[model samples]
Target: MKLPLFPLNAHVFPGGKLSLRIFEARYLRMIKERAGKEPCFAMGMLEDREGGAEVLPWATQVRMVDFSQLEDGLLGIVVEGVQWLHIEDITTDDDGLRWADCKPVSIWSEPNHEQDASINSALLSLFGQYPELGKLYPEAAGQSMDWSLQRWLEVLPIDAGNKVSLLNQLNSKPAFEFVNNLLHQGDP
Candidate 1:
């Protein structure tokens, strides 16, 4: 399917939230056209380049949930990731809006283990300390291993290259182990 693409220098995973400040004319038009139809778009991470911006292959299908004007007088939008997408082809319009032919990719399924209470509590406490992040998500954000795993992947201050490598995995076991190790590292 052809979807409008917004490449950012950030990582967004399934069930994660992202806030963007829209100012460019092409994106402004894209948002206006997408307002009532689906409110969905594809998000790709900007790849490292010598001078120009490049987007990675893996991306997330995000749905806009809220919009407002920021203090600096720019249009701000909050979006939540719905699923993963793989770009088949991409083309940019004259106005610089990118449209991509994409296919949805299935992310890792819930692991066989039960939710880790300690990790969940830590995530909850972190969210409690920052209500702004809490407000972007649904009430059930960090309640499950799947949700917690995705959230951890989203918020961790890790390298984008590592994130892209992790996302390319066919199974989520590696990601699960990674998050599990990180959580254990904080143990007293």
Candidate 2:
């Protein structure tokens, strides 16, 4: 399906929350046009070079869950990712707004119930120490290896290319092992 694209320098995994401030005229118009309609958009990582945005091929389909005017006078909107998307074609308008033809990609499956207690405790500690991040989601749903791995991948300061590579893996075992190693090494 064709959808409006909002490319950013960040990544959000399925079931993850992302907060954004919209001020650009094109995006504002995009929001206005889609208000009460679908309330969904495609978010892709952008590599800013010189004067252009080189958007990543993979993106997440996020649905707007909440919106309000921030104290700083910006339109603050929070969205939760619903699924993965692969951009098939894209075209930019005169106003610099991009519309993409994308296809849905399957999300990672739930992992086996072999979670490490220490890793789980460390993950919980992160939320306890940072209350702001904790407030974004409903509650601690990362008890599973899949959820914990996805959350780590989302917040890690890794490059988008590497993230896409990891995300495209057919099985979650490799990703789980990667997160397990990080936790064991105290990389949090």
Candidate 3:
């Protein structure tokens, strides 16, 4: 099926958090109309521009998890990425937005259980060092992890391109490892 596209600079994995500011009239109306039925949207990292905004071949679908109104009357919503989709065909609407027919791709899991465990352990260790991040992810500090990895990813400062690159990488182990290095670098 085809869906509206929101080209961004970062990548969002399934279960990742994506907070967005909604200002366009069409999207505002879309949010108002689909708020209850399907308050989810898809995001893709745009490729080199041809002059105007355009949709790329890859995108991630996300669901709205929180919504708030800004003082200026604009809307802001936090969304969680659910899946990655591959664009098959795209068409531009009058407003210049691109809509596309796409298919979702299967995510690759670490081939070895030990690698999975290692990545999880590394993430836990990394999260433990950042107490301040607990304010943003309280549950991560609690007894056990009930939330998905994507949720934790949402809070990271890694941009859309980085997110997409992680998603497109070989496997989860390397992805988390990359995150570990990036976090360590940012930690000072």
Candidate 1 regions exceeding 4 Å error are 49-53, 109-111, 186-188
Off by over 4 Å in 3: 47-54, 109-112, 115-136, 141-165, 183-188
How well does candidate 2 score on lDDT at residue 119?
56
The 10-residue segment of model 2 with minimum total lDDT is 107-116
Return the lDDT, model 2, position 31. 81
Q: Candidate 3, after superposition: displacement of residue 46 in Å?
A: 2.6
Give one digit per residue, the lDDT tens place, for model 3 in 1-188.
Answer: 67777777655666555567889877776677557554255676664555865456778777777898988888988766777788888877877666768888855443423223433454556657865433334454332221334444544665555555655655555555665565457565
TM-score of each prediction: 0.87, 0.88, 0.68
RMSD of 3: 4.7
Which has the higher lDDT value, candidate number 2 or candidate number 3? Answer: 2
- After TM-score superposition, the amount by which residue 28's alpha carbon in candidate 2 deviates from its true location, in angstroms, is 1.1
lDDT of each: 0.79, 0.78, 0.61
Best TM-score among the predictions, by candidate number? 2
Model 1 worst lDDT run, 10 consecutive residues? 108-117
